[model samples]
Target: MGRRRTGEYFSLDDAIIQGQIVRVRCGACRRAANFLPEDLAAVYGGSRFALEPLFPCSKCGTTDFVRVTTYSPEIADFGRITLRRPGPKKLVQTWENETFTERSRSNYVPDGDFRF
Candidate 1:
């Protein structure tokens, strides 16, 4: 869907910022949720805009679920933005990378042979 002019989304003509309460629905399970303008703005940088409502999987639905929304200023196009709480995978990858680097460091020797 196309985004409307930034002014259309805001009520106060002089207010630089404005937002609306919106209902979001899960594309997979169709579970719906309400999000306040402030929360939406916080996720999208608090500007007048329209965004695609992305929802979480039923199994992963929670207050911490990720949201992919967008925002556009008066003369610009809405850009995609993501709101997410890091998941287990992110933690695991971080730990794994750290461990790998540590192991490599431990195995290195000051005079280890080097070749072009």
Candidate 2:
């Protein structure tokens, strides 16, 4: 028998505007903290179908991780949710060599008179 894939849960009605965080067991670690929703999207965003590994536990010396869904306000459809996990964590970690670093993280700072 195979282990069940974890399901993501979120309450939209009267729920917090910020999406909730979900924790799932790691097949290798057998622990519930194997991977986070934030991390999942980072590692597996481009695949046609999202696929994550399962381990017996969290510390099982394996790279497989559990999967769960997250409620994103940016989603277009609610019935059929689609997620595009971003790439590795280090891909955009430092702006040292990025050519567009300034433009990417820049924001307009108005003068002192623009109080709202």
Candidate 3:
């Protein structure tokens, strides 16, 4: 069977089934990173989700210039390749003050009332 499509692009599930990892790079900063398809599928809906709009370079934060590719790593790449892994979640609480104020309206002058 052919690969499933989300709009015009193939789904991330296709890559996961093919045992491929997603590589994202920032063209402006030249920063690159590898991510697992399964992990992404879980967070980004399911395997059928479009791979587009998924990669926004964390370092440079440029989604327009980001490039996404997929490949199966070779055995020799085990030590050389470094994947971007998720870190522990932290929750912090903050307090904000809310104040309500009424604005005063400015006096209005019509165009005909103005003196040259």
Candidate 4:
């Protein structure tokens, strides 16, 4: 979606400067990173959306991009606080192959079962 002049709560520039939560994803490389307007205004000074044309994909050397979600700590998703205490520690074995990671809700399965 095109950047809106006024977000549900604040303007795009306000979301960038004050919210500290502007992000964009590379259309080619798909790399996503925090976009700080404080950094952008230096080289290209203009309305934030206007500067969208100047943003180049640092990963793929292309200008293609799409703005992603901008998160503000003051605003909670769907209106309520979403942060919760950590659940039980995960069983992480670094030496094992990454495919061995157990995502299923079942009890622990052996590493051999995880290999492709």
Which model scores highest in TM-score?
3
1-89 per-residue lDDT for model 1 (tens digits) = 22345345542221224343344545555555545545545455445343444334566564344332222333332342232332354
Ranking by lDDT: 3, 4, 1, 2
lDDT (tens digit, per residue) of candidate 2 on 1-33: 112245533332212234433334454445554
Clashing pairs in 4: none
Superposed model 2: Cα runs more than 4 Å off? 1-18, 27-30, 34-36, 46-58, 62-116
Looking at model 3, which ten-residue stretch has the lowest summed lDDT? 100-109
lDDT of 4 by residue, 1-116 (tens): 23445434434566456544455666667776654455555445525453253556766776755545555544443354333222476565454444535674365667753633
By summed lDDT, which 10 consecutive residues of candidate 1 come out lowest?
A: 11-20
> Over 4 Å off in model 4, which ranges?
1-12, 16-18, 50-53, 74-116
Model 3 stretches astray by more than 4 angstroms: 1-8, 48-50, 96-116
Q: Write the per-residue lDDT of candidate 3 for residues 1-116, one digit (tens) a residue.
A: 23334456666787777877778778888888888888778888555544565856777676988767777777877888888777786555454555544532243336543443
Clashing pairs in 3: none
Pick the winner on lDDT between candidates 1 and 3: 3
Worst 10 residues of 2 by lDDT: 8-17
Backbone clash pairs in model 1 (N, Cα, C under 3 Å; residues 3+ apart or in different chains), count = 0
